[model samples]
Target: MTKPTLIFLILFSLNFASISALSQKPKALVLPIRQDVGTNLLVADIYGRTPLKPVGFVVDLTTRHLWVNCETNYKSSTLTQPKCKSAQCQKAGTKYCHTCPIAARPFCHANTCGYYLENPVTHQNTVGELAEDVIAFSSTNGFNPGPLVQIRDFLFTCSPSALVELKLPKGVQGVAGLAHAPIAVQNVLASKLGLKPIFTMCIPSGNSNGVIFFGSDGPYSLLPGLDFSKTLKYTPLTISPFDEYYINVKGIKINQKPVPGLNISLLSVKDTGSGGGTTINTLLPYTILEGSIFKAITSFFAQQLSKVPTVKPIAPFGLCYESKYFSSTLLGPGVPSIDLELEGKDAVWSIFGLNSMVEAHPGVLCLAFVNGGNEYRAKVNIGVYQIKDVPLKFDLSKSVLGFGGPLSGARTHCENFNFTTVA
Candidate 1:
């Protein structure tokens, strides 16, 4: 072949290979589960402040099926709150007795015990059989049962490695990072033991905004390490994919002027107490507006900022706003009040006005206003401020099946996993 033709053919082949690699990248599948509504029964049974064996089961409320795997099926027992026959019971002339004297077994008295009968086809000794039963029960109930995402298959090949990458939705502002240690561990346990996935948010130190990542298990690195105690604390809001969690801050103003527009920017400032300072430290650019509350910004900021070192210290820092608009002088000089409005996802917006005068040194102030005989306010402090309040919208147009599937081997220790971004 001619040299020129050969060179052109080689370049075309390389381009084809690059395109193929990009097309085969793994994508995230986030399934939201309502921990409050659907998992009520499970929570009552598991976290009822009573110590019990960690028995896992799937309840498909949609199908009205209750699948359980206990060491013994005592549902037919005539005794209410049945207990093992003790020596005391024997001395009392009864082989066994109910713990409560007034306790009664209505099902036993009614003789309608068909539901409590054991299945003769398979003894409940095997884990696989128990899982099947649980799945069946879940299907019988109205609670929607998600498709069977094989634990081994899903985690094994969900990504090229065990580590997964997450990005904040556009319009949300905050630093990005790993979820807190306890939250991360809880999610991992839920996926491994409860066979469920969870979502969580984290913040970086000194920053007021953050982000959320949805998936089955928490990142391994997010678990308790040598410095677990130092990690930020996270509050689990809702347990479903449909519900969004947020934080709200009140009483903020811009140079004594109420922030006017629906979109507001959170900027990180250095030396907040100074009368007029311009040296600004910009962290993560912008975050989506989930709600019109400062607490929501705080929640998201704490989660995502935990990952990036440059933005880590900002998590714990307080937010400050200029009480007067274009007043140049701090609020202590009696400047006019300014109001700011921030918008998150779902068209939700929060308003905070700077009403209080700033102290000589850096500190926080609240912008106050009265409505219907009730006063409302937003928080504005003098410190570092990060941009927050945008829509919670993400781009999923370009996505591929995430790692961990049939092609991948069984789940391995997280130490064996590694993640690298494809630029």
Candidate 2:
């Protein structure tokens, strides 16, 4: 054989080996029987908590199934009849072979019926028919067999012990015990999407009287980009330096009264040394107007003790305000309002300002305003300024401080004085 031909053959063999290895690697397994069991049956007792009330009992007739015997108590009974036998053998006086009625059977007192006879050759056929007949009879007699509600399965419950048993279809191997079955099923369903489990709870079934508990799972991280669907309703206003950006947002409704004092502090994702961001307590005395949007701009001043040829790299941060309207009403003619509040920390301002400076070199300013917290107006004018440029001691009357809004608007005024210094 030629040298080149031999080399090609060796390479081909190596490629085939690699492909075989790749095919042998295990993939995520998704089990077929993944459904909310909580909704299927009423969970009277959880594993760790108090014992559950008995829902029902199980009757197993499987031959040689000793496991069933260990879990249940068995009882048996017999029937007997008595005959009037006096002088019948002597003179036939009041002698009779008394007939006993069916109701007189002793077995009836023990809650049992006639014993079932089994044969070796007919074992499979007989047991199969017996199971069907038992189920049918139980159903007709108002006894819940608790058989498999779905295919290839069977269920039995021990109400007294709060025990439940599940029988998988034949040939399906290695079924987990009842305690861990739900978790196993959950892992299978989540494998395909690479999702993590979160809170799990039982949701009440609409049709059945029972509750179905499904594990609610999601990705650990929020999607990187801003969620636009959550943003479209509220307008993103401009931010300024030194002026703490205060946002008061409310919802609007037709022919409803205006709501007031629905205010929230804008927060920044970045971390500042002082726990970065404004909180509701710090912004006290400022009332959030109902149905109106409040945006307060503040001034920003940068002071450098030493002037250098190179520009100092400063971290810029600003606030991102989000409002969720819980309820709203119509105020006056065509006026609307809502109830809302803020969430998160105080250092958010610094982080937001730093990021803002890094991304866009917008001038820093501080703004304030006064308006009713309950009304939403058509339009308003907000003030903005830089802290360094403003006079160290300026008269309130001379400065452009308070905000202007329509009379029909809520949130008429704002008050909160706190600041943080970061080097």
Candidate 3:
């Protein structure tokens, strides 16, 4: 071959090799999550800024956008505001222009994409500028983490410092929205990376850290050779107009016995848009049931555990028992299991002692569920405490929620994700 031909062949080989290496790299993103001891909320550490500083964001299940306070001492060289008419602003479903009385700064800019952001804790609303910045995350191949990858133009919002309420835990600068909205971090990752619209979360119950995996369907490998994905049971996942996730719970049972006096109709979403239905939330620490359902379940639960010595009820907890009377098992205090029957056959999510019982005081153990006041929208609101230790796979494209039964049943837990190993 001539010199030019040889040179062309060499260049082609180098180009092919570069493309092959890029393809082999993981397409998934992983974030290490830890439960906030003070608020009982979940928080994920995200890498931001040039030197890669870890920013704490409280994970919000229903928040529409990931927003951070940029009022004071907030600095990011990569931060850029999307123009009012830009595609990013349109994708965010907002065309309003943000204005500020204060001089121009990070959040105070002219003709910027404006968005209405809310504080999940205090329910306070504020209009903020929709901005983009370079954000980094650890790449994973389902089994182990790969190199740290950067998203050059990540979409998010910058709000005033006042929106950061006291209800949020200390050191947490913002709220990471994981809802179905376009601007949500998960949806943004899916659209920008061309990966599957799926994310898995393992919320740890104790002090140990948990994890969130975005953009990959996985064999959610935990310790001791266990893969959470293999054991998952899926149910139809619905979304409300506000982008909140809802699961169809057909019925409830205690120890294989149907919970009596339950108005099963209330479990279905109403067409009138008034009330009724069941939804899940990470913000709520304990599950809350409607008035009638609460009464029925609490009465039955108390009757089932009649043999266990009863103690005076603690505030917010209707029933309490002497902690010493119950024996501890792998799941928790030995008690009858509660089950939420889903849409499909044998589609039951069971709650063992670990999630069913809560220690109210030094020697008092109470039911982990709460009584949603006399009038409430959703009949049953499943909370973090009830779903703790379970692996959740949310498939946005398919509109399905996969639940991996309590990890303790398999002698593993959410904290088992091997974060120490980097691919």
Candidate 4:
């Protein structure tokens, strides 16, 4: 989406309450965010009393935990143990799953009080002391960059264990939680800088090229230039079953026919791990839908593939056939948009056939969804694969998410679209 004609103004010297409109700036420190092997990460160097090395910090919206690499290279003179006296210490006492007890041991032991989180997948431990550090977003552009933002005394766990990733190129040094929790990186920054508690990001497909902005007000309410308010859709954030950002999914329909039993309710999503709001995660490689929804979607696929000669089935991915007919199957294939009914009949999020398929091998693509087995409550995981190239903005202040695309034919610099208040 292109920026509108209105202007965004930033008053650096003004108090948080004062920077209401005009984009509330000293201009948002726009930074580049890239996808590294399914993980959305940014470069965030951690520096203590003595400077430590700066490295890539993965941004995870699903969980609220701040962690830094506990590599041996981190030997700063100022690393201090977290004091049990403060509430911050209680939260960072240990890895989230460890369930560190509330007693004295929870916050401190052997004069070392910080945190320890074991990698659930790797079973390795990341141990560190709760300490303060600096968080900065490395600039992507060669020029027209804003001043470096280094938030000092930033509280986080400094674990020494290497992040265990099944895939390599091992670019992540730590994780900065952006899940809107009390201790999240974004929340801490908003509170400290007195800026709006909101951020917007566009994850570009393929290239590690993407951008992020921080603000609370809507783009339309702020500046006309590069405003999303035009096509931006709104839905109330779902709060129960999990505190993560979720919109009420009223129904799922294909060819305008609503599928029964596919919904977002406390009972339906209680076990979905559906990062569908929690328990369900968006970063997963494939989308997992409730069995009923899965059946509905696949039924449509069967009709479309009838005359087309497709390749054989692939593992994990639900469908695969000869790719020779791929291009034909996608074009005018009578495949209708999969509409996600949200809030009211007027609100619909459409997922076309191209959006639901993933290329698996040479000249072949497959359906990237599965029946989220009985283990999960009825939930839907909006995997990254389905959202690539989509421009979305999460208004932390409003708890509303807006996404735009038919996959713009021309590249839209939505992330680079920032405004400065008139001098």
Best by TM-score: 3
Better of 1 and 4 by TM-score: 4
**RMSD each, Å:** 22.6, 30.6, 8.6, 7.7
Ranked candidates, highest lDDT first = 3, 4, 1, 2
Off by over 4 Å in 4: 1-27, 38-53, 75-81, 90-128, 138-144, 162-169, 216-230, 240-243, 260-280, 304-306, 326-335, 409-423
Q: Scored by CA lDDT, what does every candidate get?
A: 0.21, 0.19, 0.81, 0.52
Q: Ten-residue segment with the worst summed lDDT in candidate 4?
A: 1-10
The reply for model 1, stretches above 4 Å from the true place, is: 1-151, 155-189, 194-228, 231-241, 248-285, 288-423
The residue-by-residue lDDT of candidate 2 on 14-72, one tens digit each, is 33333223322122111101112322221121110011111121111111110111123
lDDT of 4 at 95: 33
Residues forming the 10-long window of minimal summed lDDT in candidate 3: 1-10
Q: Model 4: what TM-score?
A: 0.73
Candidate 3 error regions (>4 Å): 1-25, 102-106, 271-273
lDDT of 3: 0.81
Best by lDDT: 3
Winner of 1 and 3 under TM-score = 3
Return the TM-score for each candidate structure. 0.19, 0.15, 0.92, 0.73
TM-score-wise, the better of 2 and 3 is 3
* Lowest-sum lDDT 10-residue window in model 2: 132-141
Q: Residue 185 of model 1: what lDDT?
A: 21
